[model samples]
Target: MSTEKIKAELRTEFGKGAARRIRREHKIPAVVYGHGNEPIHLTLPGHDTMMAIKHGGANALLELDIDGDAQLALTKQVQVDPVRRVLEHVDFVAVKRGEKVTVDVPVVTVGDAAPETLVVTENATVQVEAEATHIPEQFEISVEGAEAGTQFLASQIELPSGTTLLTDAETLVVNVTAAPTAEALEAELEEAEAEAGIEKDEPEAASDEAAEDGDSE
Candidate 1:
């Protein structure tokens, strides 16, 4: 992926209080590490970083301009407040062009399977290694007009140039199955109600109880 240039400021203060102060200033505290170098503490523009991540995937190319020096990095991890939806901290990993990196790419299913057939995903993401600058955001699998009982495996997925699949070839990706009908839904509902100790509708329930009586008779 092409690097997105984002300016960041060096952070000297390090602590919970300092982090909170940085956030109050609408900045995101982050650290860049990798290549056997000491981690650098920095602050990024909160809104811009959030927007970049929203547009780019987690392995977003970050062209960081820190204190007049340019650095290429990728977002390694992001800590967010579960309730507030605010970014707490982020970790960036420095990378060099042409270097290979392993990261999980999301799986995106395209096209529709056969009518009355449902595409069930067994794996949501796959691990792969590729050039840092050419990492794929996701893998797209097409199941257009596939019949029921169709299954897709990881080895069957096509990888982008310079990308190699790190996941096992035997890993299941997607499977096609028959869609549940109204009668199937009713049966499932009845089973769920029985499991939850809920009363079923009267006439149908009476028939089941009578079946027991007839068996005993």
Candidate 2:
């Protein structure tokens, strides 16, 4: 993955008020720390940072220009407004080229399993150690013509050169099973409802009560 170039400015202010002021100026408050170094607080362009992250996945390597000094960093964490979905704060970890870093890469499946088979993905992502600047955006697994009773384990996954899996090798990644029939599905639903002590509501009875309430009002 190519490192995204982002311009940053050293920040002197701190606290909620200072962060709000930075957001008001269309910037995001961020901090970079790693390798036994002091955390450096800074501000980054809001739109540019957002775009870079959107284009490159979460582990996007960033080239930060802090007051004309260039530093290589990786996105460690991002805080966003829950409702607005806007960037609130960001945490970056400084990294050196060729250094290996551990990160979670998304697991994606391609192709289709054999007919009458159901594929269950047990894990959504896998942890791996790879070069800091060349972390993969995701990992792909092929289930083409996979038969029932077949399973894919973490160790079986093909990793890129120089990448090592950090997840347990015995961890189940994908499980293939015979697809349930309509009757089996219905039976399972009934069993779940009985176990939960839940029953289907009577829509006609509900409508009658609602009509009576409207009449009284």
Model 2 lDDT tens row, 112-172: 9999999999998999999998899988899999999999999989998999999999999
- Give per-residue lDDT, candidate 2, residue 4: 93
Cα lDDT tens digits for candidate 1, 163-211? 9999999999999999999999999999998999998566978889999
Cα lDDT listed for each candidate:
0.90, 0.94
| Superposition TM-score, candidate 1 onto the true structure | 0.87
lDDT of 2 at 32: 98
Error of 2 at 151 (Å): 1.1
* Model 2: CA > 4 A from native: 200-217
For model 2, name the residue pairs that clash.
none
Candidate number of the best TM-score:
2
